[model samples]
Target: MTAELILKLAGGVPAAFAACLGFGIVFNLRGKTLVFASIGGALGWLVYLLASGFAGDLQRYLLATVAITIYAEIMARVQKTPVTAYLVVSLLPLVPGGGIYYTMRYFVSGDTGMFIETGLHTLAIAGALAAGILPVSSLVRLYGQFKKHRLAVN
Candidate 1:
């Protein structure tokens, strides 16, 4: 809402987009699929940025990952591709790159206290992201089962 917030979000957009697109390429996504996956990543980062103001670090990752997973699953269904394609790419943006870096940095600097703290925090964020993905994935599988059953009946 504020100009500063908008500017920050704007700055993040390209990083998110690039991270997703690069991952998409690495994952061999082509054409519209790559674009859609990239959009998912950017949108996820934007949500993370907006929500960070209100949520703690773990919560931010959880919320962002949930949104990206949902987007990836829907896009997968529509695009006739495996959810992994989009999910992997979309999640690249939300990966705790900084956390990992700082954790390792502290460890190498012999700051065992800071290293332990940062390492635990990074692990927690990773856990939160994984937790976010599990439910949506299960829901998608359940939906697929129900749809298959209905189709078989009719």
Candidate 2:
């Protein structure tokens, strides 16, 4: 059991690392090789694992939000770029496009219950993502301010 657990945890790192590398490449393609791309990828995988373990859309959404916010702040600082770039890419994994599509299809096929549930889940994910990011961004900004002040004082 311990070995299995260790294997799972070990498996996650390479997946996360590759994801981060891919994100980094894409972000770099845009002339911004901010470290946040890698950070966002790692955070996204971590959130996905944790959220999946919880077996709920809300948890996934919240995790995605947190990941996005952290990446956004880091990108802003490292690349001296706008937060939107980081925000957009970081959110790519959690957008629930598949959910939305299935929900619409179900509705067209006259499955109201599935449609409603899926729709709700989709909305919850969206809400959670938004909720998770706001506070984190504020905190990052605060930290940045503190660092700036300390540097100036020195």
Candidate 3:
């Protein structure tokens, strides 16, 4: 990576953290929960930045989503709370808000081609998020179920 890109990524991680912290506050989170959730957002950004070297935009989104989801799952258990708090806040950095905005902008300007491209890209981002979350969540649930069944049998 170029020195400038590295500097931007460094700056971005903290910005992502601050943004998530603000969102967490809006979500009524406080103390350690807020801090950890914010860190998760920074982690997502860091992963995305790192992946930029060898991955496509969609791949970066997928990697970032996976990192954030895993973080949320772990943090939820660690904090003895629901995953929504961490997952929602942490994922703010990776959400396709810009894509959606640009898509709408193109639509409003009668640029059908750009609108179609951005809309499809936005959909693919959503798909990547879902693809990252589903398998990990399924595995976690399956592990919990199998453990519970084994204990009951014992």
Which candidate has the highest lDDT of all?
3
Better of 1 and 2 by lDDT: 1
Tens digits of per-residue lDDT for model 3 on 1-154? 7997799887999999999999999889989999999999999999999998899989999999998888889999999988888888899988888989999999999999999999999999989988988888888899999999999999
Clashes per candidate (backbone, < 3 Å): 0, 0, 0
Query: Whose TM-score is greatest here?
Result: 3
Q: What is the lDDT of residue 68 in candidate 2?
A: 63
CA RMSD per model (angstroms)? 1.8, 4.5, 1.1
How much does candidate 2 score in TM-score?
Answer: 0.67
Residue-level lDDT tens digits of model 2 in 1-66: 356545765787457656656765766636444445555756776666656655575776786578
lDDT tens digits by residue: candidate 1, 1-154 = 7898899888998888988888888888899999999999999999899996889978999999999999988898899998988888888878878999999999999999999999998899899999999999999899989999999999
TM-score of 3: 0.95
C-alpha lDDT score of every prediction, in listed order: 0.91, 0.71, 0.92
Residue 4 of model 3 has an lDDT of 78
Ranking of models by TM-score: 3, 1, 2
When summed lDDT is taken over every stretch of 10 residues in candidate 2, the lowest stretch is 29-38
Q: With candidate 2 superimposed using the best TM-score fit, by how many Å does residue 120's alpha carbon deviate from the native?
A: 0.6
